[model samples]
Target: MPKLLLAGAGHAHMAVMAAIPELVAKGHQVTAIGPGERHYYSGMGPGMLGGTYQPEEISFPVRDMVESRGGVFIQDKVARIDPARHVVILDSGHEEPYDVLSCNLGSFVPQGVVACDNQDGANGPGAAVASRSVFPAKPIEQLWKARQRVHELTRDHSIRVGVCGGGPAALEIAGNAWSAGRENGGNGCVVQLFTGGKLLRNMPERVCRLAGKVLRKRGIEVVEGSYVRSVQSGEIHLENGKRYVQDVIFLALGVRPSPVFRASGLEVSEDGGLLVDQCLQSLSHPDIFGGGDCITFVPRPLDKVGVYAVRQNPVLLHNLQAHLEGRSLKAFDPGGAYLLIFNIGGGQGILYKSGVAFGGRAPFWIKDFIDRKFIKKFLPNAPSETH
Candidate 1:
């Protein structure tokens, strides 16, 4: 029997984790490893921060989904991989050998790039995340803490909020945090977004124009062309030596793949993502397959978006089972233009698709509808009520 080991319970691995029963019935041994029992859907995470959805509504019980279906679930993380030995090294110093290994190890915020203000490194970086005022958006759960922190700080007085980066995540975080602050009795709370360049520069021009209009209308200041040098609790330091005081800071910088791939000495992309072909198999190690943000698809590079990861689910499953059974593998088609929606808080959103972009309450509803449906598909027990 082939031993199939799955690393990280992320979006691309959701289907694989849910199919543990069938894999076991087919005489395959499966084991899944992750850091959390629940895998939160990042698409709705900003909404959660804005008080539109509760935490439980946006996360899947990945560990329970695996263990209850005849697969072993290890509540740990993959520290490194020894491809030559066909072994996975756990952070706890344990080794798990596998005949075939799949990685859905998602991307991470480049926090290390920003120097922490705390010189002693005390109560930061390596410390508890919730206890800190600075937050990264990639973890998804950090947004929850940001909301709570806004609530807590706003109790005393209106607080200034700073959001770094100019990407979609930065926009959503800035917008959502604005709405979250009001719920905590914050009056005249200011939200300043330091874009470091043209706002939403990677997106379509229409998206950029519409997004800027919405943000400006809501009193959120957009600081363009000012790159961030570092961050400290309650402060933002721009590269030009300008400093602004803030009660909360959200680090929504561009995401980079986990250092595991590059650290393992495997083939990697310029961004340190595992290098893979059209089949999503690592170029240097045939037995090692990966999807999502962790992989740089060589046929054509894909953006670090959840939609592409969701689209890769079925193709990855098919290829993995086929490879294990000595059958022919299939190629992954990235599909055509996908629907892009940004929840800009206050029950408003901007929708873009097929080169067309629009903004309104209808767009927000459309995004909410689609995101909830995705959760319903995986977790039928999830609540359907909107916030």
Candidate 2:
């Protein structure tokens, strides 16, 4: 049997877990390595913040899911990959060799871009610090923990909450934060959204207008052309010389590719993501496959969206199986258009697809249904299914 190693318990890898029984039946031994035992669904993150869902509702225990399907689950962070030797080095200094390897490790927030205070004050007074007041909205689990801190802070004081970034995720975070403040009886909580450029640049103009209207109605200030320079204690300094006082700051800046790829000597994109071809196989190393936020599809540049990652699951699985069987692999076609639904809180959502955009309770319901269906597939008691 061929030993197959899977790295990262991300959305793309979820498909592999769902197909584990089939893979094992075909005489392939599968092993998964990741830092955490649970996989948090980013789709439900905003809903969780808005008090629409509980934490357990948005995540699943990864080990149980993989183990139940007859796969070995290794709970450790992959420190590096030695492509030549087909070995993956764990953070614990242990190495695992494999016949084939697949990576779906998600991205992380770039460090030192926004200075945070060092514990020893070695960086100087008023240095920006990633203390309890600063939150990076990635790695999902950290964001959830930070939300708890935000809840506690708002419970006793009226603080200015600032969110940086103009993407759909940032907009959703702003909306949910506003709703959370209201629900916590902190109506006096001032929410400010700072975008370095136009809001929802990737969406249609009508979508942008709708989002602006919603933010206005929610009393969240929108600051355009305010590129963040650095964060200091209780303040965010912008490149335009405008300073905003925010007791709590949420970084909605989308993630950059994990640095592990570059360190492993894999050919990576300018953004440091592992570069892969249409088949999702590494351009430099044929035996390696990758998808999700960790890979840059070389056939055509793709938006780093969850939809793209989820859509690539089947292709990834097929290619993996084909590679193991010594058969021809199938190319993956990333469709030009995919549904994008932004939960704007208050039981409302904005939906955009192929230049058309709409928002209302109807869209929110549609999004809720889709999210629930996706989560249901991985539930322990749910029937086995693949997206």
Name the TM-score of candidate 1.
0.94
TM-score of each: 0.94, 0.94
Count of clashing pairs, candidate 2: 4
Alpha-carbon local distance difference test for all models = 0.86, 0.84
Per-residue lDDT tens digits for candidate 2, residues 79-155, read: 99999999999999989999989999998765354666657755543344457778777877766665676678778
RMSD of 2: 2.2
Residues 230-255 of candidate 1 have per-residue lDDT tens digits of: 77666788888899998888888899
Among residues 3 or more apart in sequence or in different chains, the pairs in candidate 2 whose N, CA or C atoms overlap within 3 Å are: 116-128, 116-129, 117-128, 117-129
For model 2, the superposed segments whose C-alpha errors exceed 4 Å read: 122-129, 385-387
In model 2, what lDDT does residue 339 have?
90
